[model samples]
Target chain A: MSREHQKYRAPDALDHTRELLGKLAREVSVSDWHLVIEVRPDDLPEVALRLRDDETLSCKYISCIIGVDYVDWMEALYLLRSQEHAIPVRLRVRLDRERPEIPSVTYIWSGANWHEREAYDFFGIRFIGHPDLRRILTREDYDTHPMKKDAWPHRVRRTEWRWEDIERPKRLPGETDRRDRS
Target chain B: MSTVESKNDAVNPGSPVNQDGPAKPSFHLEEMILNMGPQHPSTHGVLRLVLHLDGELVVSVEPVLGYLHRGFEKLAESRTYLQYMAMISRLDYLSGFFMEWGYVRSIEALMGVRAPKRAEYIRVIIGELNRIMSHHVAIGDFMLNLGAVTPFFWVFRDREDAMDLVEMVTGQRMMYNYLRVGGVRWDLPDEFEAGCRKFIKEFPAKIDEYEELISDNEIFISRTLGMGIIKPYEALDYGISGPNARASGIDWDLRREVGYSVYPEFDFDVPLGQHGDCFDRYKCRIEEMRQSVRIIEQALDSICGGPVNIKLPPMIRPPAGEAYRAVETPRGEFGVYIVSNGGLRPWRLKLRDPTFSAISMIPKLTAGNKIADLVAIVGSLDLLMGGVDR
Candidate 1:
């Protein structure tokens, strides 16, 4: 009935308190009948699996996965949804920026492959269990994570090159190569 | 060939694909790596596809993006809430209006605000109209991919009229950032409604003409009907939405499922496909355009008299919370996740860009597909690289 309650009530969210407490012994409650798992980085992968496989919390759809940088501490938020019940569970994991490594959820949600790559691309957070980690949406050679506060301004190249300057060369008969002959 | 000689003389071994002989091994297979473009015209934009090919057959494709990154999300972080609203139009420049509307709506939802009822109705109308235009270009590109250039011209002729109507309403034809935080930037002028009605009235017959020109053509059907198939289950697993998901027989549409704005009031059918192939996807989009016309007609009747925008401060600093709002754009489910730390600028703004997920299914879709089918399949996905590489 309350706004706080409506925030968690989508249609099918798992309220996993007893099971989460059994694993991490962290305080968990059912707000709007949806599970809010507040866990450390180490328990993330395991907790993710529990919510994914358990019928009551079959968070089959990984609706959204995001990362927040609090300078000293970084948090990865996984918003999982159940198709049957139509409820969404909010899984939050806090990690220290110095050692920003956590088990990947690629196995759980194939969609997370790109999402994790983006998080890693922007926040420099590493997903240890990720299958293929590459610099996506940015040049592979580009270094600084631009999303970071300390990042230098992105390189700017001002050019006055004309279209005539970049035309392809034509070839002549019996040429060593079209380019070479040119 | 003085031009040729001069061009070649000025170049180093800059043609990465041309200079490398047959022996230079690429990543996988015995296939050669063909760098398609950062310049080729058929690429649609400055896209480079690192194609691992065993002759004409594509062994694998590694699409390289960010040629048009422009750092849009990062740019939004520094600009004022109102100013940042303008940049969204350029993200998926093809589906410009949808991107702008989705972006503003996400910010609005996070702020726990809604546009006035009149604004919602207008948003639905223009958004649907934009969806029709986006689909026309997509259909055009898909036809062109299959080597039909005439259909591209034919579709664009109709598309141009749609663009004209859009121009009257929001001044700029293509990248109209007409949507504002609380409401639209401007209300519809008297001519705007008349122009739209005329376009909507004539659009159905034009669509029929398009079908007669190409859709039922033996060559078009043969090339597209069975090519590039991905089942419904696989589509859902890959998080495919919009036309791509609907093409695969999944009845998931954000407009119907979530009921974001006044979409609930409009009576329209959500078309489905039994076989998720390039052909079905193409059909789904065409049909969607038809449904969009109906929605426009219904919206036009209700566009009586009321405020176009909600009453909100010129500057918006939303509460410390986050909201993810997904919309059924022409491409697919265009979602925006906005996190506000009670600041003028969003603490975080990430998009569940349909093109990103749609493009991911490319490898699976194109696995056994021939080189000719490559462009057809790619165009059918109707990706916005700006959305993908953002």
Candidate 2:
């Protein structure tokens, strides 16, 4: 209820994971929320399997797969949770901006199927080996990933019928096509 | 054309199955593609399911979502931290309080601001009330999906009563943006206790009537029992939480496990089911409502007077860090992950909606079951499209 009230703490099993992942992973640190681990794009599948199968770090459930655009590079954050320990680990993978592709973890966690598709949909970050990797939460014809910082809002994009074309159609009294008005 | 003919010949070596002759097969099997809806009523919202069916049995179900997507994560990046609170309620309209609570709690953790004692108690009270309200809808809708219409009306009647009590304090019927970053926006109204007491007193009888009406019905049991059984391991592997996961025999409730807010002070039972079936899921929700009522009763008895909100500066700028806070909503574990950049706006905000993970398991749950069972499975899961497609 108050700031000083410390009701919950991460179990000792999770504390052991910090040390284990620190030894195996590229970089490991602990945050207020969860243990953060950084791994290369190629090692994601192997690390994901270890997180799911390892005795100490059996994070069978994946909460979310978030893709953040950091201007210089794109980062993918995989929030994994071990139901047995009630501890979560944040797996961060940095992808090159020019080729934002990483091996999909759908095989490890079937729940990651949609989350990967969502990441690909928003940031145009391709997930290699992902079956049916297509745009989700957006139309199939949408050319640009709207969540990118540099991408313009859909309303501002130029379409088949521009505002100037509509204005010109209104000015021409002889125009009878409804498509012109649209 | 040559490659297609060779492949056909390879399947039926000597038989003329593909040839236009009288030597046709005795029986034919075809996978029928059926589109359930982006407009169908049973989906609960704008959700589309592309069902691959073999006669009456479902072969696979591909859920086509995004019909209700509004790009909330993208919107959060452009708005200031406090400015995004108004939109949080819209994520899960049924349990708006939990969504608002999760978002604000994450920000509080990032900024090291703790809500006062009285505010925590108020949150527990309103949060339990909202839980009951949401479960009412879940039960009513589940029954309605099985062709019973009376329970829906009965549940809504009680829900309206609960909503009246919430509106008195929050001043909004549906979208109550009452939770601020530090604490709640307003203090409890003068008649808040009396109203909640009146509802809590009569609510148990209503629940009993609801159970007697449908819980024992032959049709309801037959439809729900032994259907969509999710094993404990499968539930955890798929990241199912709240009632759905508990019904599968997983005793992992964020309220009890994480012990956020004043949930630690209140003593209540986490009703779990033995066998993970549709009936168990239904029973879990029914029992959870009773537990919520118990929690509210205790919270009301122990609540004391104090400031509901903490004083704060005009602009809230949490230091550069990230925080993830999850709360037990009626659906499941609803969480908010905030990445602050020592600025007014969040560098990135991601919503970990429990329904999103629950819905992902649909293809596996619906496979091999009859087409009609799809509705029951989805209904028992208690998904919210607003949370799923967000």
Instruction: Compare the candidates by DockQ and give the number of the best one.
Output: 2
What value does the lDDT take at residue B20 in candidate 1? 50
What tens-digit string does per-residue lDDT give for candidate 2 at B73-160?
9889878877898999999999999999999999999999989989999899999989999999999999888889999999999999
lDDT of 2 at B255: 88
Tell me the tens digit of each residue's lDDT in model 1 across A14-58. Answer: 234464347572546554244567788788877778767777766
lDDT for each candidate structure:
0.76, 0.87
lDDT of 1 at B275: 92
Show where candidate 2 strays beyond 4 Å.
A1-15, A153-182, B1-28
Q: What CA RMSD would candidate 2 show?
A: 5.6
Candidate 2: what is its chain A TM-score? 0.76
Compose the digit string of candidate 1's lDDT tens values, residues B238-353.
Answer: 66778888998978776776667777777999999889988899899889989999999999998757888777887888888777667778888777777778988887777778
Write down the DockQ of candidate 2. 0.45
DockQ of every candidate structure: 0.20, 0.45
Number of the predicted model whose lDDT against the real structure is largest: 2
Q: Which ten residues in a row have the lowest lDDT in candidate 2 chain B?
A: B21-30
